[model samples]
Target chain A: MAEFDKNMDFPELDAYFSKTSEAADDRMALLELLKRGAVAYRGTEELRKKCLNARELLPKEYRYLEFAGLQKLIEKCKIFDLKNYSRELIKCIIIGVCYYTLFQSIAASAVIFILCLIVMVGGGYMTHRKNAKKLETYYNLAVELRGVFPELELEEDYCSEEKLMSLYDIVQANELTSLESAVVKLKAIG
Target chain B: MGKEIQWLSFKTREQKQADLDEYTRWVFKYGQPQKEKVEQILSRLFPKEAPSMAMMTYLLGRDAYYGRYNTKKSSDRNPIKDMYDVLSKKRYQVPKKDIPLYMALIIADERVSEALDYPPDDVLHVVAARLMEQE
Candidate 1:
């Protein structure tokens, strides 16, 4: 709970920890070592044991540099802009209802409106849910890839929202082949 | 009686890797694409330092939450409240003070920063926000 010594000079602390064996007592020094990606501490047995203990004392998320690094990347992703999505969906339903009221009888419009609402909400929810799930999977894969290939720089391969959106569209387009197959079967039967 | 402090727990390695096979399949299905557009935008907006997209999003979300677009009064803005709103939207349960510390830890961590390499005037924005709370 100690405030980061606001004046804590990085270069000076780096020098201090690099030279002294007393770094094990300093949480910041342990963090410095973790920052250096020098997890395998090559030091005196007492220093190494103490450093290990210090690492254990640090937040678990900070303990593994890879997780911390990958997490930084995953955090970049905007899985679902839920607020924007709901706002747009509501605006759309309002407009659709107004159009229906102008064009149809009240009883018919009410039935149609209820059906449209269900379809719009259910369909929107499913699509967003799928996209969110896909993005989460993508993030987890990025995280796990760090462990399997520590040398790999995941930032270079990070997916963007635009790319993912386009890819999802392409995947959906490809999925239409199943519908095509069913149509061909029906045509032959007819 | 003194209050007991409970430290945060980490995910177990086994739990972490449990669905690696499924994850690999998913990643392969989606395919990894380089975020060149994001890089371009970040480079243009923050020519000096790389503020992670997460940081950028948090700042933007904070502004949106405050209806900054509609308000002209500087007194109406509250950075601490905005920060909490953004964190809550993400469902994070971190302590307010720890939030800045966590940001500083990641920003200063060399290995992590290397992965997040870009540019930031936004870095100053982050530091300023933290210092604002300190004062």
Candidate 2:
């Protein structure tokens, strides 16, 4: 058992030591038992309380720590989910345009046979070809819009909200047929 | 020759329109809110207003094109290089942290591939990489 003081910084510790001192004449025996049981229990309880406090301090959105969890949900129902599908389709189109531009450059080199051979060896050729054509078609349509509305420069920063909204409105207005419907569906979800 | 001219009947235009309407309404009710929350988080991190709708559409369209296909190698032309050149000429600067959000948002719309006037993925990747370097 240890000495206890009322004004001790650790009042709980003082109280514990005092109780152990009263339990036995042999200070060492009483101190040993209290050290193993009471001290350990208090320490564990304090740790648990601290952990809860830390968790409470986090933002409400981050409290759940559900970024990956939500992503999994989105991936699970992507196709039927209009927003997910729209978003994915847009990504696909962007990739397609990159591929098309690259292909056009390669085609200009007049090494058509070499390009064909390279594509044959590449596992993604089929998907790449499909996306390229689709992006080309979309680009053509967008150029036509540029002709109609000269002020809306299609070649400016691609991520501007104004540009996105204008394109969304264009798509919503059925300017590009099936593609327009798809854009509208994406906006609805986004 | 006469058999080839037959118009196939599936769902009527009215039924298709109704389906589209219901789908759009549901998306707006649930998906839009979540997307907005994500965008808010991005704005706080980047301290910039979200990109304009037209810009987003074009970007998304570009992303769609790249995401779906692989670029062909050319002797004098690199698709990624071209993207960097185009982006460098743009007036607005796209910070790095916000690139993922932009990609995610554009990809969120399936029609992005059809909406863009140019390749978006290469430019997005270049910009994102540049932004990451600063971080």
Candidate 3:
């Protein structure tokens, strides 16, 4: 609502909020945090507040967020903000270009195809690198989760989105909690 | 407005204790072999000193979460993320592999680097990822 402050240096929300966003950044960032199982390590105040924000923005899968492929999922969301019907819009553009080029000149069609191929390759390579980084992050997260929950095991298939979601459920279930703050009154009473 | 936030409710003393009472149980009860290995690793890393409370808290927390003694409220928390947040605060390096072990040492032994301050992240991504690979 308030431009979301591009450089808002709130460490409390670093692991919880997204760095950049338009309007949905909060929602997306919360989703990202949930995917990384931030709910596990994140403290009480932050988790509760953020979950409240996410409850409306995200679907029901917040509790079972998986680190795997979430970048792509987020990217898909980002794509939507760029255009109303981005996928359909692109398809229309491609079809229009193809028809024009086919009638204009066969040589032009080949040239356009080559150009499109190069752009596609460049885009693809960028996506690949991005995916690799996200994958490594997922692995690192798996390692951290494994540290606490050995049953997570970090098997070869552990990186799969669905499998990781299951593991995240275990993380949520096995998180370490303290009664220090909440039970202070109770302890004093007893 | 949005749906009311249903963040996890805090556990009472009994509930919290019911969820997590002791750290030793990981070593003695569930993760005996891994505990030994982790202890050996800590000892080897810091021959002069034992791990600090912060480090032990995370290590043991992780073990208990994975082990049988964990509570139902355990699902609401995450020791790894907590530890990483603390460990990553330091302005130094941690290893990519066995980060949990190394962060425990770094947090335990403040002498690891001069730049590091307290309150590292709860989850240790990679030992070196904190310093060398800051995302």
Candidate 4:
């Protein structure tokens, strides 16, 4: 392993260390554990248990590496979940009740309620779709990231977000494409 | 109508050259310590056809120094992708197919610059050696 000039200033590194160490508690312990690298960090039972317990209060995603920039990019990519729509549904109901109570007109109340439902649910769905696309793009970015930094192993498969149809490319290959000629040649050879 | 080509939106030659020059200056100034290590790894790995330090430094620092890795510059493209695009067009003695390896070097170097403070700098050498083993 090569040695870095310890005297150099690195705000990004310091910021990440302080933030993550603060999150996990026991700054020295977390730093020591991180020295083992992200892949090895998961396998260490006692340290991992301690970190995981502490991490639970922060967010579901683990800080896999001390690479602050990459970690921040990963954090920005929100995992799409249908469960997030439940809040929208609850909002719709509240709006419907309010409309009915205020107007005293069932038709107007129903219309307003439906409109609110459509707007809220529709907006949520649009955002979800946009996030899904963003997630796919993020996955592709991750695939490219791992290509260069192979040592950094990710939990998700690189191709997990790729659309099935985009996986293969069709190309021309003379004899391979000419089924009839190939079949005739095959028959003659046989 | 056909979709607008994204490359059309990319910076012109003068802009790119200016960016490259700025990046090169930054690398020379701050990356002096890592230069020997990078050169050492390059010489060891590509003994027969080592790339020039100028090219390596340019590619390594181009995005990281410019803060392109930050989320504020939101775009479909990234540092690795930009490097890949450059490598494809330019003859850097580095094959376009081996982008992953170069990318690893560049990214590891970027991490160091960004101060992945805990693992220490030896990790960079470890990564280079590990990559060498794989090659």
What would the TM-scores of all predictions be?
A: 0.23, 0.18, 0.21, 0.26
Q: Cα miss at B22, model 4 (Å)?
A: 5.8
Model 1 per-residue lDDT tens digits across residues A1-190:
2233324334432443354323223333323323333222222234334434444543444444454543443343234444645755675567567867698566666666567656775566666565444444544554443333243232212122232233333323333223223234434544
Worst 10 residues of 3 chain B by lDDT: B110-119
Fnat, 2 decimals, each candidate: 0.00, 0.00, 0.00, 0.00
Between the candidate structures 1 and 2, which one is better when assessed by TM-score? 1
- lDDT string for model 3 (B27-134, tens) is 334344545544555555445554564345445334433433334465554433444543343442333244445533433332211212122334232333432332
Per-residue lDDT of candidate 3, residues A11-40 (tens digit) = 422332222222234333433433554333
Worst 10 residues of 4 chain A by lDDT: A163-172
TM-score of 3: 0.21
lDDT of each: 0.41, 0.39, 0.41, 0.45
Ranking by TM-score: 4, 1, 3, 2
Predicted structure with the largest lDDT when compared to the true one: 4
Clashing pairs in 4: A2-B122, A148-B104
**What's the true lDDT of residue B94 in model 2?**
53
Model 2's CAPRI class is incorrect
lDDT of 1 by residue, B12-117 (tens): 6685476554543432232232134333543554454445644455334434333443343556555344434444444544444434533333233222221222
Per-residue lDDT for B1-135 in model 2, tens only? 112333664777897689667744533344555445434433443454644542543343343334322344444343333333333333535543454335333323322222222123344345344333432
Q: Which stretches of candidate 1 lie over 4 Å from their true place?
A: A1-85, A148-190, B1-135
Cα distance off (Å), candidate 2, residue A6: 70
